[model samples]
Target: MTALLDLVLDAHGGLRRWQDARTVHAEGSIGGHLWSLRGQEGILATTDATVDVQQQRLVFGDFTGPGLRGLFTPDRVAVERPDGEVVAERNAPRAAFAGQGPDTPWDRLHALYFAGYALWNYLTAPYLLTRPGVVVEELEPWREADEDWRRLHVTFPETLATHSTEQVFYYDTAGLLRRHDYAPDVLGGTPAAHFSEHHVRASGLVFPTHRFVVPVQEDGRAASEPVLITIDLTDISVT
Candidate 1:
């Protein structure tokens, strides 16, 4: 294992705990201008997400409307009623976003796919660095937040569903992920800077409760305005 990877995994509650985990549950609300821009406002205003620990699957409870459910996997996104009546579903959902720009409005399936894959990756990082088929290299240190943060340039294989094939993660001295940079393909490769903060532990794992995404500036820094997405998590549990 790489030295930095070891530090990161251990800091985030360790690989052993993660290996023993089957699923993670968190209650949170996601909001920002991006929602309104994509025409998916209020879908996740007050919802709970259940992530399958070892698979790229996430289900949002009461996600689309009153007493509805949203299921997201790498290959499919569906909205169903509480009794399992399918309201809407799409196959190969990523293909539906082809040739789209940041301003292009997304349908409900598009929003579900994006939210599912994005959070699945975010909630399982560093350990993701340890997964098979992932390439991880320690890059030159980055100076941010008045400290020098270590950088990891990660390349995900086709098997992983994520924001992009390649991403850069910045970790503080304590090995907590502070910032992540990527160009989201669904947004026509919009360069974005995602920040995670206020980490707390649940079921022997660590996670950030307050997270936000902003535009990446020309100088490789985060812009101060126009928050694209904000997520506030609470009551996180894993088993």
Candidate 2:
């Protein structure tokens, strides 16, 4: 399991090399329109964010307006409204931000990314390598990677029910994640989908600078027609 974890890390640019680094930084634009929750008018929005990894903190300023800010730390999360009023706040366990156990694998790593990418930049494959009980099931080739590449799929254990959905990660020859896919578990439940691309290396690590996610429609049809939200990360720092 440890060796397997090492392979995963090496695929993402080596855990040791990433850990020894003091910080990582990134800059980019995030812009997309949201399908109105009520199916009314689409809301177009954009944001500019900076992630400071050493302190495990993030600062985001919405580009669409003034004073929209969000800050995240190891122990707490806070978001500020456009008017500068704190709109929401929460406390979380410190370990939640830390990496997983030695027995963890790619499936758990995918889960971590799915569950936490909305809140933190603490994801790096090494954390998943240590988590226990996560099952990694190899999937047969399902799709072509591109005009010149091939793709592989892997699954995680079901945490919800027998019909509960499992995380699916798509990787290329170099073992970097090129895409992620998952379906809904409950009948009539909205299917969840997430896709990431535009990978680039900065500060000793490979990272996806742009990503988009949407929930499948209630009718079990296609996911949300218009993207609900798109995140653009910039000024990312790992320390």
Candidate 3:
């Protein structure tokens, strides 16, 4: 394991603990005008979500609207109703976005794929770095707010369905992740900076309850104002 990843995993919760805990449950609200822009408003709003950490599967329900349950695996995404009837299913969900851009009109399946994989990736971080095919390297320290923050440049293999293959993670002296940067390949590779804060611990695991994803300028820096997406997670538990 890389020294940086070691520190991060230890800070959040030891790798052994995370490995033993097979799943996590989170009930919360997920909203942002970014969804509206993509024609997927309310798809992920006010939901109860569960993630199978090792299997990389996510199942969520109790959306803002009725008859919407989301199921996502690495290779497929499915939307079902309360009656257990699937409304949409897509194989190789990531490929469904081929030649798509931010302005592309989104369908239910598209929305499911985007939200499902995105949340799965977020809820399983640092620990996910320990998975096979992930490459991690220490970068020069980044100074922000008069503090020297350690940085890790990570490259995810194709097997993982993240926004992009390459991402940068920022950590505080205590080894908790403070920020992450990547371009959403499904969204035409738009650059974004995600900030994590308001950390709360549950069942030996630490999580940031508040997350913000903002647009980045051509120089690959965050925009001056306006967060594009905001995710607030409450009632989080790991077991």
Model 3, runs deviating above 4 Å: 63-67
TM-score of 1: 0.97
Which ranges in model 2 have alpha carbons more than 4 Å from their true place?
Answer: 2-6, 21-25, 31-69, 73-76, 80-135, 145-165, 183-189, 214-225, 233-235
lDDT value, residue 191 of candidate 3: 83
- Let me know the TM-score candidate 3 reaches against the reference structure: 0.94
Q: How would you encode candidate 3's per-residue C-alpha lDDT over 7-29 as one tens digit per residue?
A: 99999988988898889898887
TM-score winner: 1
Model 3 accuracy (lDDT, Cα): 0.85
Model 2 CA lDDT for position 236: 55
lDDT winner between candidates 1 and 2: 1
Error of 2 at 152 (Å): 8.1
lDDT of 3 at 127: 83
Q: Candidate 2: global Cα-lDDT?
A: 0.46
- True-structure RMSD, every candidate: 1.0, 9.9, 1.5
